[model samples]
Target: MSAASEAETRFEREDTRRRWLLSTPALLIILVAAVGPLLVVLLYSFLAPGSYGDVRWQFSSDAWFNVFLERDIFDDTLAPAWAHLSIFWRSMKLAFITTLLTLVFGFPTAYFIATRDERTREIWLFLITIPFWTNLLIRTFALQEVIRQEGLLNTLLLKLGLISQPIPMLFTDFAIGLGMTYVYLPLMVLPLYASMERIDFRIVEAGYDLYASRFGVLRRIIVPLVKPGIIAGSILVFIPSLGAYVTPRVLGGGKSMMLGNLIELQFGQGRNWPLGAALSIALMAIVMIALLFYVRNASRGGPTHG
Candidate 1:
């Protein structure tokens, strides 16, 4: 090689080496802080459950099999774990419902904030974020009070004569969905407003000038523009709502068991660490699937509107 080419190659090698050296700390942190626990859980899932809560050294696939199937003690026949299936169904249903509910409420709220003057927008955005200042558990407890019989909601209904007695609102699936929606509404709103804020109002006016009705302008112009935000916000709301523990526990009174609660039950009272590890891996897999779906859609570059 020529002297100049050799010198350039040497410089490139040193630069690459330096970059690796600089990134070593971050790589180590990720390996230890993130990958380590996941590795431990993955290992535990293949092990046998002990008589107590921990796992035995022996390898077993019972935990994984038990994820979807259970053996009936009476006839020694294997059957689908209907209880687990129902809990999984409920989790998915509630998460989807919560996403829809938040979108329904957040789209308009985001538009309102995004359309306001800069100062007013700041105030409105600040109000939207005020919920984040409080701890999640505390916020959940506060929600519990609202839907509890004889609390604000039922009391208002009673005073207004809308109901003869306080409605049985608390400790139900309705309470779970309501709590999740309230908790995740801000997540939906912030992303939507980010997308809406960048919109040019002139295009909307141009659509109107072309004799487009209010709904037409919204359907063709506004939604197409904010599609990215809708996807992001729905993902943000849905993922956490699926894995939620505290909100369901307080609101559902432990009757409405989500996947999170089920996992906890395995590790704690059920004394099935292997099953818990398997469940944890299953939850992680579901999360990865959701992320893959998001990535697939988020990477598609076709224009939402012509």
Candidate 2:
């Protein structure tokens, strides 16, 4: 080969090597931080419990079997296992509601932002993101205070003679769902914005030129184009909402317990590590199955944004 060609080839090889070397640390960190913990958890899920609530090295499927078979764990007046199942279903419903509410509130706002002037879009986007600057727990607590009987909302309504008594807003499923939607709305918006921003204005204009109604264009073109964003945002909101402990714990009171709370109980007051590990694994399995179903549907739906 000519000297110039040989030099270019050597440079490209060295560049590839340098890039790989640069990426190695991040890859290692991800493996150590994420994969390592998952591996430990998976191992723990298969082991038996020992004295003092330790995991014994003996391999056992008792915990897994109980979870999979939905066998009752506690033989009380209110079966603890049934209670846990009820909590799981309730959490799932709340998560689904939160996801739907976020989508309803976020999609139109994102679409408007995406279609607006750059400066106006930035301002609206900034407004949407402002809430994220504060701690999520603080935001949830703020909502809790606002919804309390003597809090700002009820006080204002009472002064206006809107009601005779302060509404029992706090420690209800409605409050918990509202808290979840408030927290997760931004997550839904950003993805929808990203997806909508990529849509070609030309295609939309073409639809208009072909005498398609605005509603038709939106329903046919925009919605299909934004399906991936919808899926992503739904998954983002739903999964976290499912595993959420604080919002339900605080807003739903003791009555709004979820799988996350159940897991926490196992590790805390319950002192049943094996059972906790089993529950954790079960939760993970459910999430994975749901994610797979989402992926399958999204794939069948045609082209995705990402």
Candidate 3:
């Protein structure tokens, strides 16, 4: 072979080897950490729980079957041989509310930050992220303190003569939803800011130059540009909110028992690994379905004007 052809062949071989070498570590880590555990969970989901809380070698569809067609496990403190589809739907509803609230509050804030002067934007972004630097548990506890009966809010309300007694703010659905929105707001905002910041100013200006109304320009130009961010932020907030344990447990008390809390109870207090595994798999399925929908909608390139 000619030297030129030989060199090209050698370079291609080296490039192939280099690519394989670079990708090996990431592939190995994924196999070991993610895929491996998922396989274990899948196996565990099919097995019966032993007397000592270990998995039995015998296989059973009982877990999956119970999750879909049995008595409501969540109806009482004790395990009923049933599925709690209502609880799943309620968690989804709460997650939806939280997502919408986060979007409503986060969008304008992200827009301003994205469109502002660089240094000022940085400062504002830092301020937005400041809450995240603290531990999430600490933040939730702080919220508990603020919203609890006889807490700061109630104290101020009483001092202002707004009410005769402390409002039932803590241990309510509203409080849990509000706390979730607060916790995930930054996740929504940062993505939105990123999407908005990437939008070309001239496209917006051109819309105005063509005599488009402010609303028209926003509807036609801005929405499409930021749709990805909106979807991303929604998914980010919604999925976690659906499976959230701590915020609801702390803020909602017994009133806002999410699937996460239920699953935890099964694994911990209930000592029902089979049910917990089943519930977890169910939750995972819901999240995956939601993600598929989000991806489908996001990929459609946003809303269209009629």
Instruction: Write down the TM-score of every candidate.
Output: 0.90, 0.87, 0.87
Per-residue CA lDDT of model 2 for 154-220, tens digit only, reads: 9999999999899999998788878888889999999999888898778999989888899989888
Tens digits of per-residue lDDT for model 1, 179-285: 88899999999999999998888899999999999999999989988888998999999899888999999998998689999999999999999989998898888
RMSD values, in order shown:
2.9, 3.3, 4.3
- Candidate 3: residue 94 lDDT (0-100): 85
Span of 10 residues, lowest total lDDT, candidate 1: 297-306
Model 2 clash tally? Answer: 0
Clashing pairs in 3: 70-82, 70-83, 71-81, 71-82, 72-82
Which has the better lDDT: candidate 1, or candidate 3?
1
Per-residue accuracy of model 3 over 1-306 as CA lDDT, tens digit each: 999999999999999999999999999999999989877877888989776676788889888777767544577343543336777877888889999999999999998898898999999999999998999889999999999998999999999999998898888877887899999999899988888888877888999999999999888888788988888999999999899888888888867567888888878877768777888988989999999999798768564321
CA error at residue 151 for candidate 2, angstroms: 1.4
Best by TM-score: 1
lDDT of 3 at 136: 88
